[model samples]
Target: MDWDREARTGLPEAVFCAGKTPAQIDAILAEARAAGRRVLLTRLDPARRDALAAKEGLDYDAASATAILGGPAPARPGRIAIVTGGLADLPAATEALRTLAFCGFAGELVADVGVAGLWRLLERIDAIREVDVVIAVAGMEGAIFSVLAGLVTAPIIALPVSFGSGVSAGGRLALDAALGSCAPGLVAVNIDNGFGAAQAAIRMLSPRGGTAQNAGPS
Candidate 1:
């Protein structure tokens, strides 16, 4: 763990828990505790979360597969809007929201506003326009990315979710769509990388200074 990441990059180092074993996670948590640090764990599946539940101060969210060891950072100044193409994209959106929360930034989830139902997204356009940054989550062809980017003035971060079958099975189609989008200034992250999207928003929110502090464990 790079303990001084928050001081150097304006964000703390987060543990990616995809391939880590239970004992390894335990050791990391133990080290963090000894150092009196606040840590965020991403990609923490349910089984791992259950195994580590005994650790005090462990806050887990199964939907997004995320955990916070100490606690969320204090609220900071920034408004983020997370828009999802459909109900199936909620998991990815939730991850972005959780990341924002852990980083001390607040985000509003605008769910199920895909281009399939143009009226639904149009209805919420005003609210989505009020934020400093926008994260658009979608699977399938990912037309929502371009649509939202064209509609919103804030920078758009397209998060392609792996939530479809057939040709769109693993989100490659969505990823390609996001990459090929003609919308100017639209950027994209990997498939289902909500954490990355949130980090981009954080960078945009704090371009000059880092809002996060390396505080002791709560």
Candidate 2:
């Protein structure tokens, strides 16, 4: 596959591995790298990482149940801040940051500051305000988006993950929470889609955001 669309439009191709075999993963990786584009793989099982470590790079953060590929770290300008509900949400946030890096865009990761404690989010307002975009990863009520929308002027990317348990209504509670938000500028990608969120942010930050015309955002 021609993977240059990512670099061409400032959006990277994401390989979601929540349900793929090692062979499939390897094939995708080979194709992506062959096209001279960065390859970002997320949510791999522990054993899978070990199986592919020799051929593919890995940043194993066992606590987060995440396997990261920080390849090509997109050479982007401007800061993109990543905020998670708490330490529990690090895996997803790290995934977001990793995806950003793959597109050559480095970003800041802020965790353990859920809106439950308003003061925590308040303290980071100054720093959060400076980011060109904000990726809010939350679960179990996921009210973080509403609070963040009120706090920052930058475009907010609300990501609802399967962080909540059964009674927690899976991630729907979080999804509903974000959608219910009255924030005009706030937009959502998909469930636990940190890679997608990061990709969109870069597009907006690139070449004055959407003004690049049919030539593909110069």
Candidate 3:
């Protein structure tokens, strides 16, 4: 089924189900199970996940719209810090947490830290700095990336969540803010790409199966 992606990339292929039909998703799941491989499906609807989970060895997290086959990885070192700008960003933040759990890393969630009330973030700065890498999830201009970069020495992985309408809507502005930030240690993933962000952190933290304590920023 051409699932050799894991062999080449050192990461498993994830099934993105936004446009795929149920039968297609089922076929892919079957193939992965047959090969004894672990798989992740993103953008899956709740009803579909509930229906599939009934008979398959799948566990679903509706908040993240993600489903996992095969058990999670064994626990490892290097914690991940997931910071969300607002409540609207929880879904994506949860996605990063679930992905980090699957990847065998512990993750901490710092919620509702939008720029509008910078105090929320400042209060949690000490906790956030304790992690190996930070996944900053935000919408509406994504100032969290630059702010965190300025304060912490950890590597910041920006995840821009898309919502709202018109020009600054759908996370374009947020994505731009992260990419265009003058901060020294900021990195970025696509809009709502929590899974990708998690993978990046995992690789950075566990390069060659070793802790990244001295691997430099993130």
Top candidate by TM-score? 1
Q: Please give the lDDT score for candidate 1.
A: 0.91
lDDT tens digits by residue: candidate 1, 1-218: 88877876787799999999988899999999999999999999999888873567988888999989888899999899999999999898998999899989889999998988999999999999999999999999999999998998999999999999999999999999999999999999999999999999999989576644644543
> Candidate 3 lDDT, tens digit per residue, 168-210?
5999999999989999869999999999999899788755734
Rank by lDDT (best first): 1, 3, 2
- What's the TM-score of each model vs. the native? 0.94, 0.83, 0.88
| Model 3 spans with C-alpha error above 4 angstroms | 50-54, 208-218
Compared with the true structure, what per-residue lDDT tens digits does model 2 show for residues 58-172? 5555543454454466265779999988776776777778767666778898887897787888898899999888999898888888888988899999988777777555678
Q: What is candidate 1's CA lDDT for residue 75?
A: 91
TM-score of candidate 2 relative to the true fold? 0.83
